[model samples]
Target chain A: MSTRWYPIYQRGNPQLRVFLPNFWMKLVRPTEEQPPNVVTFAVSTEMTKHDVKNYLEKIYKVPVVEVRTRIALGDTKRDQTYGYITKNDDVKIAYVTMPKTEAFKFPDLFEKKAEQLEKDEKSMDDSKEGFRKFLERNKKRPGTPGWFSI
Target chain B: MSSTLMKCLSLANTLRTATLRSLLTSQQKPTLAPWGAVVPALASHVQAVSGIHTSAASLGLMEFFDDPKVWSENEVKVGRAWKPDELRIKSNKELHQLWYILLKERNMLLTMEHECNDKMEVFPNPERIDKVKISMENLETVVRERNKAYHLLETGETGERPQRLVHNCFGLRYMYKSCEHVLPPFMNIKWIKSRNVGFGGRAVRKFLLQYREKLYNEKRKAKNRSRNEVMMILRRNPDFDLEVLRRQFPQVNIDKLRNEDKARGHYVPKIGV
Candidate 1:
């Protein structure tokens, strides 16, 4: 059956099952410090706690001991000069609890970023030095093209 | 002491070989390993599998994060979306599995984007999210088409929700999608009351008259704009092809417009040349 139109559930009717559920849930880094077993998630606004539980259990196979959800209001800002107001979409945040034995810590994604940036800076400096040396070499011959010597 | 050293060396060699063998076996049968471990090996099996995949154990919350290799990179290149034609040949089971895959990819992208924003870093290759979205849309469309075909063959009707053109209380006509109701039309008092609204008052008639006039004015202005454009083109290029101009602006009567005074160029016409 097409998920666009789900059959209404009446008493004594068979349970409704979603074959291709469009609901999306993203595991997000918690804004605050929490227990290791408690994970944060930003789920679709339409999804309930039960939906989040089932999604994790069935699809990702993540065992969930408990689920608590809250809809966080999106930020609203007024244009500084235009006097117009704009609002961001509100997100439903689901806090899932795993077994006490299951502990997860959000990994630092950009730990190597600083090192990479330093390496990039080093290369950039090398290029700049090379260009400076080329300019110095060509100082005597003002009209000489770069390809004339290199 | 020499015999003991030799025995220790031999025992360490056996341990190393045993670990190597286990690792090779795990890598060879990726389907038997955990979901996270199977990702690298799944590339070859993706084309061969036509049914649902019972992936090994989950990656826990770590599945939300991207691979560590790309975390520091400035760009991540990926292939394009799945086209409808490509999805059409696949069975429903494969499409369902693909949907979950796309969904996870989208979630991963979104999570990374959010995290990047939080860290004030650039989310590399943002177009990857759009690609995943396009694929999901195409997959849904293919599934809908199959559903429609099946319904038509078996039930003699498309299994789509019923909708009808309805005039609202504001006198604006719109397509109102009908939903399933527990009570019939006569039994549902609230629905009957909501749907019973009719537009008739003098105020509404005046509003509709003004609205129609506005629509007519827009149409008239568009026609005049096209006519003026054609006149300008003819004025600038007097020897312009009439057939091409006629095809370009079919609404503007090019034949009648050709002899108009406005269409005449500033230069004097070559008479009887």
Candidate 2:
């Protein structure tokens, strides 16, 4: 059966199961600090606390103690130029509590960003230096082709 | 460590071994064609490089994020989506596994996109989502095709949702996809009542009449236009191929129009007895 076509669950009928679930869950950093055991997730709107628990336990094999969920209202702001209001989509957030021993601190993703920028700057400087050296070399022979001499 | 932790460690070890074994087996196999060597080379490179893989972990929190290398990169390159023909060759089990992989990739991309948007940063290579979507769609289509073939073999009719041409309240015809219901159509009073729509009334008749007249006018005008074009062509070029004219303007009678004075060109035709 297609994913969209769901059969009505009667009292005696065999339980319906989803084979290929297309639901997506993203682990996002929480705005407010919480216990290390508690991890936040932005989940599909259709997902429930049970679904979140099953998803992590079965798919990712992460041990979950409890699951708390809330629907966060999307931000709304007025347009600066035009007097119109713009709103973002509502997101369902799931707070999954792992075992007491299991501690998960949101790792700083962009910690090495400064290092990468420095490396990029170094490469840019090298290129600029090489170009300047080429200009210096061609000063004597003004019209000489770049590939003409060593 | 807990028993679950031990199980996870073992699972991770087994997974690593399985991946390595596959890589080795693939590389050892002889290439059928000269171009076939590229797959093994690329596969091995992708499999071996752990540093380049940003979030490769065993049931860890890193599973939700993208590769660190791609996070700062301006562009992320990806191959095209899986074609139906390519997917058709894959076994059901393989397709199922591939589907999950694609699903995870799509989720990762979406999460990254959201984070980027939230940070007011440009999302790199947004087309990656579209690629994954197309792959998932193609995968579903392949599965559906297989299901249809099997259903046709077992059952006489296709195991698909039944639909029929139905008219709406506006008197416009459309295909209505029918679904399974707990009660039969006759027993469902609410459904029956809903189905009974504005199929009558003087307004509908008048609207249909005007609509039909408008349609008829358009058709009539097109016929006249083609007829006039044929007449004009015959009048200008008398020696024009009647066969070609007949093929083009089949609605216009060439023989009848040929005898008309209007069809004759300004230059007199040379008559040989």
Candidate 3:
């Protein structure tokens, strides 16, 4: 059953099964300190606490013990020049709790960016120095080709 | 001491042989279960047995890519997106299964794309995501078509959202989709009163008049500007194609425009010999 429509539950009817769920959940870093077993997620607005629980358990294979969700009000500000007000869309934040034994920490993806940049700059400098030396060696004989070198 | 050492060596040898035998027997057995028996066996054993192997091999999350080993490879080749004709032949159950697989693939692609952007690296074969998106859209369209047909057969309505033309407070027309409401229109006194405050007040009429005038003036000026431009072009180039100008500006009357004094070129025409 799609989340858009739900049939009324009868006593003897079978439980509903969602064949194609359209909900999406993105793991995000928490703005505040959180428990080691708790993870934050930005999920589809249509998703409920139960949906978040099932999504983590079934799709992500995470053992979700409990789920809590809240709608975060987006910021609103008046335009500096026009004086018209604008607001961003509200986002649904889901806090999924895994088993006590499980622990998760957001990995630092950009940790080595500075190091990589330093290495790149080093190589660039080396190439520039090599080209300068080559030019110095051929200063006297302008027409002489690079192949003439030892 | 010598007797004790000899006894320990014999025990170790026996243990070693037992371990070797068990290892050989385990190796002789199937490396893995055929995937059919791993899940609950269906009532129809023959159908389940045949379907399991085929579905296990071809369908589901397992077939999204070549394998884990191919992840580190520089390049991997795959066929084009699934054509509509090929998907049309599949059963509803199979199509449903394929939808989940595609959804998972799209998620995986999005994750990779996000990581690539974060790393400031060019995402390889970005078109692969587009192909998957197109395939999913086509699949959804096919499903929706079938759903609409089935609904029409069962129910009198088209099983789509009920919508009708509605006017807003500003008197602008828009389609309003009717949805389920907890209270009737009569009971909803606030809504009824708000809706009763219909548009087209004296103030609104004045505003609308100026707004319409503004639109009309812009259009009128644009048309006049284009007409003047056409005349200037004709005056500059007497040999200019009338058919091209006529096609270019459909609003201007080319025949009447050609006879105007402004349309005549600066140089005098030579008299007939």
Best by DockQ: 1
User: TM-scores for all candidates?
Assistant: 0.83, 0.70, 0.60
> Local error of candidate 1 at B270, Å?
3.2
> What is the per-residue lDDT of model 2 for residues A99-144, given as tens digits with 9 covering 90 to 100?
9999998765556656766877898899999989889999988988
Question: Model 3: runs farther than 4 Å from truth?
Answer: A1-20, A76-87, A111-150, B1-142, B149-157, B182-197, B269-273
Per-residue CA lDDT of model 2 for B52-150, tens digit only, reads: 222223636666777766576555544456678777876776677667667667777777887777776677778868877887888888888887888
A1-150 per-residue lDDT for model 3 (tens digits): 122455556678799788677676566667899999988776788889999888766664568889989999989999999999999878799888888988877655445556655865797899999888889999998868778979
lDDT tens digits by residue: candidate 3, B1-273:
556446545543443344322422353321111122222222222111211112132222232222333232222232245567656765686677666656656654555455556556554456757767787777776776677788889986667766899888777678876765556888988777766747768987887789889999999999889889988999999989999999999999988889889888898877793
State the C-alpha lDDT per candidate. 0.78, 0.73, 0.64
Residue A52 error, candidate 3, Å? 1.3
Where's the lowest-lDDT run of ten residues in candidate 1 chain B?
Answer: B45-54
Q: Is candidate 1 or candidate 3 better by TM-score?
A: 1
Candidate with more favorable, higher TM-score: 1 or 2: 1
Report the TM-score measured on chain A for model 3: 0.74
Residue A139 CA error for candidate 3 (Å)? 11
